[model samples]
Each structure stands twice: as C-alpha cells, then as structure tokens.
Target: MQTNEIDVRVREILRLALKTDVPEEGSYAREDDPNWDSLKHVEMIFMLEDEFDVQFAEDDFAKMGSVAAIVALVEANHAA
Candidate 1:
C-alpha cells in the first residue's frame, strides 16, 4: 500500500483505539499521550494487525510509539 494510504488507516486505528481524533502531526507515544495507555496500546496493536492483515513480531511492539513508526512497521511487514 502507498504511504498515504497507510497513514490514513493508521490514523483511523489510532482514533479508534485511543478513543480520540488524532492530531495530524504530534506525539502519539504512550509516554506523551495519556490516551495511549497499556490497554489501548495492545488494542491498537490488534487493530493494526487486523487492519493490515499482518502479524507483528513481539519485538516490533516496542517500536509502535508513533504513527510514523506504525506505518513503517506495516510497510515493512507488508513488503515481507
């Protein structure tokens, strides 16, 4: 999928999982965003996996802190 498409889908997943409309550009990290708590983080992972039809490795979970990182991970896994 194209980067823009990935971005749009990622944003939607974030909005659903985080239960808020995500900013166009800002920190989505659990450290910085109160909406990204532990439970929501896991939910976000599941949503992204289901949305992209790709399973993420355990190691990749830590890198899912921002939309850019999530998009990159999906792109990489989709390519593989």
Candidate 2:
C-alpha cells in the first residue's frame, strides 16, 4: 500500500476502534485520551485486522498500547 493509503486506513481504524466520530489529525491520541482503555484495545485490534488484512504478530499485542505504536507497526508491515 502507498503511504497515503496507510495513513488513511490508520486514521479510520483508530477512529472506529476508539469510538470517536472524528479523529485528531497529524497527531495520535494521547495515552490519557478517554478513548484509550482496555475495552477499546480489543475493538482496535479487530478493526486493524479488518482494515490492514494482516493479523498482527503475537508480539504486536503488547506493543500496540498507544496510537504511535500502531502507526509504527503499520508502517513497518506495509513497508515489508
């Protein structure tokens, strides 16, 4: 996927996962953002899988605690 495509997918996934009608642009949601929580984690994972068509590796679960982390992971996988 192209970089812009990855970005679009990431934003959409994050928005759906966090249950936010609109996602902040150019920056990730902060750790303390009300949308960031345990329950949302599962929802995020599912949305990510559906969006990326990639099942995250086992280690990814622990690494994907924050939006920045997911952005990195998605970039890495898309680049791979």
Candidate 3:
C-alpha cells in the first residue's frame, strides 16, 4: 500500500484503539495521549497487528510510540 493509505488506516486504528482523534500537527506519541494507557497500548498493538496482518516483535512494540513510527513500521511490514 502507499504511504498515505497506510497512514490513513493507521490513524483509524489509533482513533479506535486510543479512543481519540490523531493529532494533525507534529508527531504524536502514545505518551502524548492521555487515553493511551498501558492497557490501551497493548490493545492497540494487537489491533494494528491484526489490521495489517503483520506480527510485530516484542521490540517493535516498544518502537510503536507515535503515528509516524507506526506508519513506518506498518509500511515496511506491508512491503515485506
């Protein structure tokens, strides 16, 4: 998928899992979202994995802290 498409889908997943709209300005990290607690982070990771049909390694989960990061990871996985 194109980067823009991946970005849209990732943002959708973020909205659903984080229960909030993604920020339009700058890179928004999980810590930036008050709603993104530990439980939600796990849930979000699972959702992203399922959505992209990609299995993220345990280390990858730690890297998924922002929209940009997730999109980049998903784009790379999608390419693979």
The global C-alpha lDDT for each of the candidates, from Candidate 1 onward, is 0.89, 0.73, 0.86
Checking candidate 3 for backbone clashes, the offending pairs are none
- TM-score-superior candidate, 2 or 3: 3
Q: Looking at model 1, report the run of 10 residues with the lowest lDDT sum.
A: 24-33
* Per-candidate clash tally: 0, 0, 0
Per-residue error at 33 for model 3, in Å? 0.6
TM-scores of the models, in the order given: 0.90, 0.74, 0.88
Q: Compared with the true structure, what per-residue lDDT tens digits does model 3 show for residues 14-73?
A: 889988988654678877899988899999999999999999878888889899999999
- By TM-score, who's the top model here? 1
lDDT string for model 1 (1-80, tens) is 89989988898999999998787665455666787887999999999999999999999999999898999999999999
RMSD of 2: 2.2
Off by over 4 Å in 3: 24-26
Arrange candidates, best TM-score first: 1, 3, 2
Estimate, for each residue in 1-80, the C-alpha lDDT of model 2 and write its tens digit: 66666767777877777767545556665465677787888788888887887778888877886566777788787677
Q: What is the C-alpha RMSD of each candidate to the true structure, in Å?
A: 1.4, 2.2, 1.5
Q: How many pairs of residues in model 2 come into backbone collision?
A: 0
Model 3 lDDT on a 0 to 1 scale: 0.86
